[model samples]
Target chain A: MLNKHPALLKKTLSAFAVLIFWIAVWYAAAAIVGYELILPSPLNVIISFGGLIRGGEIFAAVGASLLRVMIGYIAGVAAGVITALLTDRSAVLRQILAPMLTVIKSTPVASFIMLAWMFVGNEKLPILVSFMMVLPIIWQNTEAGLSAMDKELSEVAEIYELKFAKKLRIFIIPSLLSFVIPALITSMGLAWKAGIAAEVISHCKNSIGNGIYESKTYLETPELFAWTAIVIVLSLIIEWLLKLLGRRLMKFERI
Target chain B: MNEYNIKAQNITKRFGSEIVIDNFTCDFMPDTLYSINGASGRGKTTLLRILAGLDRNFSGILDIRGKCSVMFQEHRLFPSLSAVDNILELSFEKKDPALTDMTMSTLSSLGFSPEDMKKYPDELSGGMKQRISFARALLFKSDILILDEPFKELDENLRSVISDIILGESKHRTVIVSTHEIPEIFKNSAINIQL
Candidate 1:
């Protein structure tokens, strides 16, 4: 309806206005600093970003980084779900895994990257780090979801004599999705940041992290800003895509 | 062989220091309607839960012969599913045209329009949700149908209609219903168990 359309338009316009205000503030800060080396202007960063796009290296870097993080993210999600299911069924397993997961969650990402570097290659370190960063988040949320399931609904399932698979499909999965989707979206940002940090620490080749490191090493501040922009943009795009997928999955579940 | 569909012997349920049900015994026959009448907090739901095998923290010898379909006092419809899907999810025979037809007809009999069938629980009124819950219990293939406070939110006309439907569908099953007061339609036909 026209009412909803106007509300949506207003929201988009408000977001654009906020973005423009921040950019103007950045421009003023850059001008006041009077040094491109210290603070690159928004225009200079945009130009640098355009040059990187023209060079076509940004595409390869983005692709490689995306693939690495996605693989780790998927594996982490699978492991977390499996672990949660196992632990939910057995208190002994939950007690055994609880301390390990707590350790993983509390450990810094940089420490994990450095520790993993000794055993894994530079290229694979990022994957391991991303996986570690995501595993606890997904596990905690999935476990909470499992515990928070409606006891009454479970009674209904039992009374109706629903099979295990049917009960999972009709009840467990849908309930878990509500918790998992948010955890997934939140952990994705963490995974990407942690993966990049790992790559930077390890100096992995042909990656966004390596590009940023190289730019910093050469004191190409504008290019560094440009690479950072790319990360932000890509993270936003991925989060948006995940949100869309979540909506579709929820719809399918309802059906 | 046992002659009863369900037989409970000397059942006693307690929550810490408080006693909910004390030394209760009963036998439920097949193809019979029984109404459990009691005051509030008089262990009606507790007894129903025990019979449905949902509660195990009780001292009792309980034997149930066949599958049970229970409509709880609360309309516990799945929030994510549409009204029809909530009913249809119980059908072990999935995608059966006859089952779908039966589901539609059953919902229709409960004053649900075709449009209403597509609505989720959040979009339905309390009475409508109760009807959906009732319809789900009626449609599921079970030998025992247990309903707790099934007519709490319905008007008199709806109560009459639902009681008739309950009577019709429970002809071949053991029906154990819990209500504060037995409805007039069930007065002559149903066995009253007072607690």
Candidate 2:
């Protein structure tokens, strides 16, 4: 047990050391540059972060952006799953919708943000953009997962004449969830990036994107860096939480 | 005493012109075990797949009645679940507790104790997992048990134990097993079908 303990500790510390080294490199580079306007040091960014926290603007902006992104994320996941199910059931529907989905996936985020801003209120523009950005991701992955499902399992279902709920529980959901959660984790990152970009373009009030816009106008490089850091940190936290939840959900599935 | 319970008539399966099962016909009866021995790539798995109602592309007329359960040779246990959960997947909510309890008893007879039931597929050895797969099929309580070389990885002693348990448990049902090794099965009254 003692020998095993050291090996596990070594592995854990190695990962931690990598993170520390990167932070150190970042700090040194910022200090060497010596231009707060161009590259604010980590300390300056932290100070800016502290200032924003004290002012309560950071909290409001994060909350607003989070809410919008979550709404859009949920909508996109729902639309993607329902559309994939429909297309799976009918080849005609797949043919009709395939081109449009492809175009949506390939189009640039900025272009969608601008176009979406025209059709909806500025507040809703970020949500719509996020939804548009995340839909194809969930659709394509989920369809692939469904396509790759073991035919033998479906045979079992048919042989037993399993009901709809039982079929979903026993076969379909397990296969789909394996793909969907990973897709969702990836799409959440995309959603936040795209959603915030839309907010920045739309100049929505009380949003992190608007804070970024303000930092740019004022040439507050540290503020910009600080907000960017916040975004990265928040996204990481959410991703970690989501992954934990995904694991728990998998355990509960009895798969 | 011999009534043709299930019949496969003119069953021809073709995969893009290469025939897997070529115009095969067979009949099965209750309370008797049927064993099929054939060369490799001789449509053994294909026949089982068709009989399990998984393959519909084959040209055939199958007159089958009553419930059917199958145990593929691959031991297709769900990788993430424990042994007990895999068996439970085949069971219905409305099934008799007595039947489910009998399945547990069968698992015990095949050397899978209650403690082993808690372990996942990756945690168990190949032979142990195979028995879990066998346990699942037996627990399904079907009219016909479609087993495809279920005792592949077991040692002689374990194989004999499983064979005895299977023979004893399936007295009332028709059991069809496919295997290339005929001597290992040791079923005295099985109608041997060579494909």
Candidate 3:
């Protein structure tokens, strides 16, 4: 379904050509230098990826990572959305909770992970870290959505004597969805990246990060590159799925 | 004090020491059409907003009866919804059929086809949007209908059509419209309050 416009095709082809040229340069440099340890060619990376796929460890690592990240990300998003709703309803509660979440947002993920390690298992560290990273993002965006809701729409609701549930279901949810979808997509990516980072640092069992750690310790450069590729692909797949779900949820026909 | 269905007594409104409505008083009787002709920025829309209970910061002693509806100068139809859905949002179950038929009839009267109800606001022209807004306001069951220059954007023929519809439909209800054009229509047993 890609467009067949000549200019667009030229641009796309030129970009791919540049990518191939770079890979060729890397291969040439490895051959001229005559050192496999210093610079492994793209072929070596591909061979390593194929070997890993044949061994079936890549899918296992990817599945483990995806499950952990999805669990933590969904929990973070739910908590953040609920907290935002609560704060939006009560100014006093917002004032009380605002500074604390602000501090959480400003704090470093590494610091949160290390602190979390003191009280939780290594398995829980990734989830906690991911939650911490995603909470502020979802909360801030949801609060912004609530604040940006049109006053006139509320006036229309009042003029018609729309009940609380009707107003929330018909008006507020749509307003919130418009804002939350983009924010949630953004936060989910952050959650996955931070969750894997936490797992790598904590050396969690049966995780992609553990495989990354194992590869690094054994000086398996190709394996490290493969895992990185897996992470990128997984992240892209997740974001694409979220976007599809978001578009389905925001069917303007229903609105 | 007057024997009126709705009364606004010495109502005053200010925005940060800038007085908008200074002790403004008015009376409106049931089943009568009144036009409040006013200059721009002279609290005409603000007064309508206050009467619609959207603005509660004003100092006013007003008495109103029954449910109220308002038609803003800018057609405030939801851009995502169809004209029929916009009207149906404010209608009651008991009057659903009557409201729908009336809404469709009004739109048809205003030169809109039957398929117009299936179109979203963005697809419609400005005057078409205004007609939908007018239809929504007129079809809603309300005692006091506040229209802020509902016929401002229509052409001569459309304006006349809307004016006649407004006059005819509001015969049993109190209608307060703010407009500068067509002042002669209000001069016949209709109160003309000039600001």
Candidate of highest lDDT:
1
Any runs in candidate 1 off by more than 4 Å, and if so which? Answer: A1-18, A247-255
Tens digit per residue, CA lDDT, model 2, A1-255: 546799888888898999999889989998899889998888888899999999998888999999999999999999998888888888999999999997998888887787778899799998998898789999988888789888867665665566878677767888788888899999999999999888888889999999999999999999999888888998999899989988887776644
Model 1 TM-score, 2 decimals: 0.92
Question: How accurately is candidate 1 docked according to DockQ?
Answer: 0.44
Ordering by DockQ: 1, 3, 2
- What DockQ does model 2 achieve? 0.26
Question: Candidate 1 residues B133-169, lDDT tens each?
Answer: 8888887888889999998999988899989977876
Q: For model 1, how big is the CA root-mean-square deviation?
A: 2.6
lDDT of 1 by residue, A48-129 (tens): 9999999999999999999999999999999999999999999999999999998998887777888899999999988988
Candidate 3, residue B28: CA error in Å? 3.2
Cα TM-score per model: 0.92, 0.83, 0.87
Q: How would the docking of model 2 be graded?
A: acceptable
How far does residue B104 in candidate 2 sit from its true spot (Å)?
Answer: 1.9
